[model samples]
Target: MEKAKAFLDKLTEEEHERVSRLPFKNDFKFYEDFALLGMHVDLVKPGLVSCSFKVPPRLTDGNGNLASGAIANLVDEVGAAVIYVEGLPMNVSVDMSMSYLSTAKLHDELEITSRLLGRKGGYSGTLVLIKNKTTGEVIAEGRHSLFGKPASKM
Candidate 1:
């Protein structure tokens, strides 16, 4: 328990520093950390979140393309934003999968579109597409499944 508490304290400190360095803040404080990666939420409707992000050099793979993990992170985070905007309980991701269609090189401006596919009971499904804004080339696509807490817990 002591170790876990120490770890949480360290994580919180790191997140605080990261948030302080953000160029812009968003309505979601937890998601605001992504701003350091140059991600901006262009729209957030009931079950959708449209975002614009630039592939920074630091997030590149060995081949100088956007990292798959980075894309997956974007997908997962945006999907969570979609759920949050829907007045649902903050959920835990049960599964997430991504398919790489093409490569996005450093400095590429990518558009990320995420929408909640559906919500049944306490479960939610979401999909995200990452594409090059100029060419409409798909960079990656992903799906996420999450289970929200019961309403009584919210």
Candidate 2:
């Protein structure tokens, strides 16, 4: 366990230095821009969407597996895309529930798919699944709920 401790100590120091130099500004990046940086949209329909992404080193955790936060970000982005319309304001995430079934390693190709569950007025729900493309292993699943501006009745 000494090796693990040494590794952790080094990574912690690096992260500490990185965070200490941070200055808050409007230049902050959104989750979509960061986590979906390398994502490629494959297919899209009114209530369904599919994407292809290779697990990048920048999105991996200490164990070399895809970071859980990255998976969650993907869920939010892809889930919203399934229902997004041109010229419409983006929906805001209300709640998200996720189940991490497996881990994805660096350079592993992933297939992400999202499907609409149902909608009510201004609220919508969707389900997203992330899986390793080669091994067909399921990586994660998320249920996302979002709220948008209500449509006009006229």
Candidate 3:
């Protein structure tokens, strides 16, 4: 974590400001939920990232269950957050495939970890896994592909 923080600290002021202005970081709802759930940026690299999200009641769906969409959103956010923190311009999700391996109830804290798998030109890919914090069970997994040039290219 300290290493990641040090990496982030090296960003120029202009770079940091550009990243902070990303839609995911600036969205009030996303920011509020990330803060409320105790989500933290743990590690980040060019195409890899890991973060954790604490499940709270407010994140549950209508069936009193943790919605798969919510899980997907968490995965996407953490994966994208990694790129943003690295001072890269925001990329758009071109495709996202998800599978719900298990169900989670309210208050079930989750750790969402993602890694950049590969990239070709302006296209990049990532893999994400959502695991149960207590039981260490994998509740969900996903793969996302993003399309966009690097921020510096813009």
- What residue runs in model 2 are displaced by over 4 Å at the alpha carbon? 1-31
- Positional deviation of 98 in candidate 2, in angstroms? 0.6
Candidate 1 — what's its lDDT? 0.82
Error of 1 at 25 (Å): 10
Of models 1 and 3, which has the larger lDDT? 1
TM-score, per-candidate, Cα-based: 0.74, 0.78, 0.69
| Selected candidate, larger lDDT, 1 vs 2 | 2
Tens-place lDDT per residue, model 1, 41-122, is 7997888889898888777889999888888788878877787733545798999999999999988899999988998877
Q: Candidate 2, residues 65-101: lDDT per residue as tens digits?
A: 9999989989998999997866778899999999999
Q: Candidate 2 overall Cα lDDT vs. reference?
A: 0.89
User: What total of clashing residue pairs does each candidate reach?
Assistant: 0, 0, 0
If both were scored by lDDT, which would come out higher, candidate 2 or candidate 3? 2
Residue pairs with backbone atoms closer than 3 Å in model 3 (clashes): none
lDDT of each: 0.82, 0.89, 0.75
- Against the true structure, candidate 3 reaches a TM-score of 0.69
Best by TM-score: 2
Cα lDDT of candidate 3 equals 0.75
Query: How many Å off is the CA of 73 in candidate 3?
Result: 0.8
